[model samples]
Target: MSVPVLRGMRWWDIAPVLDLEYELFPEDAWSPGMFWSELAHARGPQATRHYVVAQDPAEGRIVGYAGLAAAGGLGDVQTIAVARDQWGTGLGARLLTDLLQHATAFECDEVLLEVRVDNTRAQKLYERFGFEPIGFRRGYYQPGNIDALVMRLHVHDAQGTGNHG
Candidate 1:
């Protein structure tokens, strides 16, 4: 298999991204309008959002995508998804690393995200990236009534070390 290439997501990538989004999160997939709104803020000098897509070079397909929004010294991970076949391939970590890099570029002091409480795989990935559980949003996910686990990571230490500590 060829290594996937990661690049900034654009308006043209929305169609394939939506397909992967729905495939991965059938119950809570983001609507096209939601993605459009996020993309709208991802450009220009005053942009507050960063979104990226991973493309399979061999097949020219979007295999993963991630987004982040930052403001007021904080960044929030909007979403991250990898195709099932791409799981266990470090695609999730790559996507997350990209987001964190963007958070740092956005001068964020901390980053936050919410994951489905039942999605242990994603939870572990976040933990590996130095995020710590902070709280829970009761019944945060719709349709299924799944709770959400809120997690946070400090982007840097006071001394300017880029360590999550």
Candidate 2:
């Protein structure tokens, strides 16, 4: 497998990113308006927010993407998605590592995220990065009405290993 290249997401990348967002998150997919809103945040007062796209070197198209918002000691993983075809190809891990690196660069003491209750795969990914379940939000998701698991990761410890949990 070719190594995936990571890059800062540009305005032009939003369309393709939105396509994958819909593909990976059919039921709760964010609309174009929402992605635009997030992009604006990425360029606004929250300029520290990191939004990135991952591409397969061979194809040059976006295969995955991730977002993170860092303010002082707190970080939040806004979202993460991988093309359905690349689900188990480790692209998600690459996107996650990039987010964590960005969080660390921003000097974030901890990173937090909310994962759908049924998304154990994502939970495992977060767990692998030192995130632990801290709480739950009842009826956090709409339509299906699934709950959300709130997870947090502390990145201030001395041992800054790449993989923690």
Q: Where is model 2 more than 4 Å wrong at Cα?
A: 44-46
Off by over 4 Å in 1: 157-165
lDDT by residue (tens digit), candidate 2, 15-84 = 8888888778888887888777777767755477889999888988798999998887899999998887
Instruction: State the lDDT of candidate 1 residue by residue for 86-156, as single tens digits.
Output: 99998998899899999999999999999999899999988878889999999989888999999998888
lDDT of each: 0.92, 0.84
Q: Return the clash pairs for model 1, or none.
A: none
lDDT of residue 135 for candidate 1: 100
TM-score of each: 0.95, 0.89
